[model samples]
Structure formats: C-alpha cells, structure tokens
Target: MTSLDIAFLATGAITVAAALLAVTTRHLVHSALWLVLALGGLAGCYLVLGAELVALVQVLVYVGAVVVLVIFAMMLTRAPIGPSPDHSTSRLHRLLAAVLGAGVTALLLAVLLPLGGEVVARTPVSTTGIAEDIFGTWVWPFEALSLLLLIALIGAFAVSRLTRPAGEVRR
Candidate 1:
C-alpha cells in the first residue's frame, strides 16, 4: 500500500481508539483529553485529504477553543477532578448507541462509495469563489451559527453565575 493509505489507516485507528476512550473513561478530564486526541486525528485526516483550511479550523475550533472551554468550565464548577461517580452505562443505551453509530456508518458508505458519483473529487474552485458562494448562498446559516455561538456564551455565563457558592456570590 502507499504511504497515504498507511497514514489514513493509522489516523483512522487513532480516531476510533480515542473515541472509545472518550466514551468509556471514568474520569471526565480524561474523557475530554481523549476527545482532544480524537479531534487531532480528524484534523490529520483532513490534512491527508488536502484540506488544509479544514484541518486548521478543526484544530483551532475543536482542540483550541471548544475543549479548552470545556476544561475551564469543569474547573470553574469545581467538578470532581477524579473519576466520575456514574461511569456505568445501561445495556439499552449501549445497544442504542451501537446501533445508531453502525447505521450512520452504513448510510455514509452507501451514499458515498458509488451512489454519490465522484463527489469526493477535488473541485477547481478557488477559495475566494468558495467564500463568495458561502456568503451569498449560505449567508443565513452562517448568521445562524454566529447567533448560536452567542447564545452558548450567554448560557455559559448564566450557568456559571447560578452555580456560584453562597458566600462567594457577587452583587
């Protein structure tokens, strides 16, 4: 096999292992760290596929911003830095998750392998054209995403404020 094939296989394995660890780990911090590894693996996959912008955004948005925010929230809440109290998943939930994941994988393969008809091939469009298309045709979704981020920020502030200790409450 080619080097690209080998790299893809390795990254895929790392992603899966990290995802499993993220789900199964008893400690929340460890789970978040595992998620970082998973996101890193995804970024590597994007790089392999020649999507430098996507890879950079994946690393910056997921690893740098989102995960850091999650860790900071954990610290702010004074959540248990050790293993979580509830690590056991019910059999039904486990089965449901497995079925959902398998179904999604099968659907993706079915749609992309042959039925999609060469959609994965790199297009010749320039980055400026792509940006223009997004800004022109997909402006609503972009604005909605910004609004969603604003709402999330507000919610985080509200949660932090509500969870403050009694004696530490600020006016």
Candidate 2:
C-alpha cells in the first residue's frame, strides 16, 4: 500500500476513536478537546484526498471557529471538568453498545464489500469556485456562523459578569 493510504487509514482510525471518545467521555471539556482532535483528523483525511480547499475549510471553520465557540460555551456554562462517577455505564448498557457497534461494522462491510474498493473519480474543484459558492449561494450560513460567534462572545461576557464577586464594581 502507498504511504498516502497508510496515512489516510491511520488518520481515519484516529478520527473515529476521537469521535467515539468525545461522546463517551464523562468530562465535558475533555469531550470538546477530543472533538477537536477528531475534526483535525477529518481535515487530514480531506488533505489526503487531494482536496486542499476542503481541508483548509475543515480546519479553519471546524477547529478554529466551531470548536472555539464550543469551548467558550462550555466555560461560560461552567461545565464540569473532572470525570463524573454517575456517567459510568451498566453492564446492560455496555452490551447494547457493543451490539450497536457490531451492527454498524456489519452494515459498512455489507455496503463497501460490494464495491470491491473501487476508486471513484472526483472532479477537481477550484478554490475560487468554492469561495464563490460559499459567499454567493450559501451566504446566509456564513452570516449565521458569524452570528453564532458573536453570541458565544456575548455569552462569555455575561458569564464573566455573573461570576464576578458581588463586591466588585463593574468598570
């Protein structure tokens, strides 16, 4: 196998593991950090697929903006840091999880095995075209993202103000 294939598989495995950990972790902040790792791995996958624009956008939009907003929101909401014992799973739950995981694996194999690992040709997409599409057609989503960032900043301000000691005067 080519080095790119090895890198892609390694990155995909990291992405999947991080994503699973992000959901299963008992600590809130740790979940967000793991989500960042997962998103970074996704960007690496995009890079390996020869889609530089997509990789850049995945890193910038997801890791830079979305993850930062999530972290800020967690901080603003005073999310728990340490693991919570209550988050522990029961044996029944573990069994159910294993079943679900195996089912998913079976489904993926059933789908992909039929294709015989065929490589589909993808049209080379230009950055200029992507930029135009994002800015022109999907302008509302861009604006919404900016709004979300603004809201996160405002929430951070409000949270800081609330946590301030009562004796401290606002500047």
Candidate 3:
C-alpha cells in the first residue's frame, strides 16, 4: 500500500475510535472533546484524500465551529462535567442498542461489499471553483445557516438564564 493510503487508514481509524468514545463517554465535556478529535481526524482523512478545500471546511465548520458551540452551550447551561447517574441505561437497553448497531453495520457491509472491486476515477477539482461555488451560488444558504446557529446560541443563553429561581438575579 502507498503512504497516502496508510495515512488515510490511520486517520479513519482515529476518527472512528474518537467517535465511539464521544458517544460512549459518560462525561459531557469529555464527550465534546472526543467529538473534536473525531472531527479533526475526519479533516485529516479529507486531507489525505487530496481534497484540501473539503479538509479545511471540515476543520473550520465541524471541529472549529460546531464543537466549540457544543462546549459553549454546555458551559452556558451549566452542564455537569462528570458522569451523571441519571443518564445511565439499563443492561437490557445497552444490549439492545449494541445488537441494533451490529445489525446496521452488517446491513451497510452487505450494501457496500458489491462495490469493493470497482475503482472510480476521480476528477480534479480546483479550490477556486469550489470557493466561487460556495460564495456565489450557496452564499445565502450558508449565511442563513450561520445566522440560525447564532440564533440558537442566543436562545440557549436565554433559556439557561430563565431557569434561575425568581429571587436570583444576574450580577
């Protein structure tokens, strides 16, 4: 195998591992941190695949913006840092979830196994073309999404503040 292939594999492995940890961890902040690692690893995988723009977007949009927003929301809401017993599931629920996950994995493998032998040629994409497309055609949607996220952040802050007792006042 080539070095690029090895790098892709390594990054993919790291991404999967981090994603698993992000989901399975009981601590809220730790899960968000693991999500950052997962998203960063995904960006690395995109880089190894030679999609520099995609890699940058992955890093900027996911790892930089989304994960930061998650952490910020957590802090704004005063989320528990450590494990909470209230979030724990019973053994039966855990077992069912595992079984469902395995079944979905098997289904995906079954669907993708037929395409394993086929190699599709990739066309080179220019960074400028992508940038123009994003900024020109999709600019409004992108700006709208950003505005939506900002609104959501503000809403979270408002809700968190409203949760205080009647006698409590902001300093």
Candidate 4:
C-alpha cells in the first residue's frame, strides 16, 4: 500500500527465500553463504523498522561472528564442502525444527496481538544512549565474554592439535 510497506515486504521475502535456500542447499559452504544472505535480509528488515542498532548487531554478531565461527568450525572439523553424503539435517530434526518454529510463531502472535487486534504504537529508541550504556556500564560483561571466547579458541586449538597426524609435532 505504501513505500515502507513495500520495502518491508521485499526484505521479508528476501529473508524467507534465503532462509529456505540456506536450509535446502546440499552444499555445506553454499548453505553457510545462503545463511549470510538470510541474516542480511533480516537485518535489512530491522533497518526498515527503524531499529538501526538491532540491524547493526544482527549483521555484526550473527552474520560476521556467528556465521564466520560456523564456517571456521566446519573447516576445522573437515566437514565436506560439496554436497553432503546425507542431508544436512535429518528428517526428524527438520520436523522438530518446524514444530518449534510454529510454536514460537503462535506464541509471538498471542503475546503481541491485542484482544481487539488493534496495533500498539511504540516510541523510537535512541542508539546513542544504548551505546553509552553498553560501553560504560556493560563494558565489564563484554570484556568477560571476550575472555570466554579466547578460552574457547584455545580449547579448539588444543583439540585440533591433539587430533592431528601422529607424526606431526605439536604447534
């Protein structure tokens, strides 16, 4: 009906299509790449909703960090890059995922929609204040998370090194 509505619809469509492709693709690497597209589209949708900080976090955290971590994990585990020998997700897993997704959808609708189905107005949030709060009060937790990630990296390296060929020297 309007330009903003059209933009939202377009972003939502891209997100759905990319998410479907991500799940359905046979190739592992291609699935990860498609996931990036899906994540980016969701971030775009967040941007269209005026949630700039959320969009940025979605792109930076999910696409940049999580997806990269997954890709690296796949490489580290020596997962097949081409078409998987078997489906990426088993039939039972897919069925469970569908059920979980549907349940979440129902829960959200129940919570967000009013008894009369009237829309609720929301006030826009300021990104500057959020950034200030994150950098100031929440800095310690952020640093702690960084330390935890470092420990995880060290553990991964240890595991990989231990699993290397017997003749190979420890790194």
**RMSD per prediction, one decimal?**
4.6, 4.9, 3.1, 4.3
lDDT at position 171, candidate 2: 36
Segments in model 3 whose C-alpha atoms lie over 4 Å from true places: 166-171
Q: Can you tell me which runs of candidate 2 are displaced by over 4 Å?
A: 85-121, 156-171
Give the alpha-carbon lDDT of every model: 0.80, 0.87, 0.89, 0.83
lDDT for each residue of candidate 2 in 1-171, tens digit (9 for 90 to 100): 999999999999999999999988888898999999999999999999887887998999889999998888777666657875656788899899989999999999999898987989978788899878988999998899889788877977687667677799643
What ranking of all candidate models by TM-score puts the best one first? 3, 2, 4, 1
lDDT of 2: 0.87
Question: TM-score for every candidate vs. truth?
Answer: 0.70, 0.74, 0.89, 0.72
Best by TM-score: 3
User: How much is the lDDT of residue 80 in candidate 1?
Assistant: 73
Please report how far candidate 1 places residue 88 from its true position, in Å: 4.3
Tens-digit per-residue lDDT, 49-167, candidate 1: 76676688689877987787778777655567677546558889889998998999999998878965655676675667656766789789867865876676666666766655668
Q: Which ranking of candidates, highest lDDT first?
A: 3, 2, 4, 1
Candidate 2 or 1, higher TM-score: 2
Instruction: Write the residue-wise lDDT of candidate 3 on 42-146 in tens digits.
Output: 999988988899899888887888888888899888777898777789999989999999999999999999999899997888989889998899999989978
Off by over 4 Å in 1: 86-88, 103-122, 131-147, 163-171
How many steric overlaps are in each model, in order? Answer: 0, 0, 0, 0
Which candidate, 3 or 4, would have the higher lDDT against the true structure? Answer: 3
Model 2 lDDT, residue 163, Cα? 63
Q: In candidate 2, residue 75 scores what lDDT? A: 75
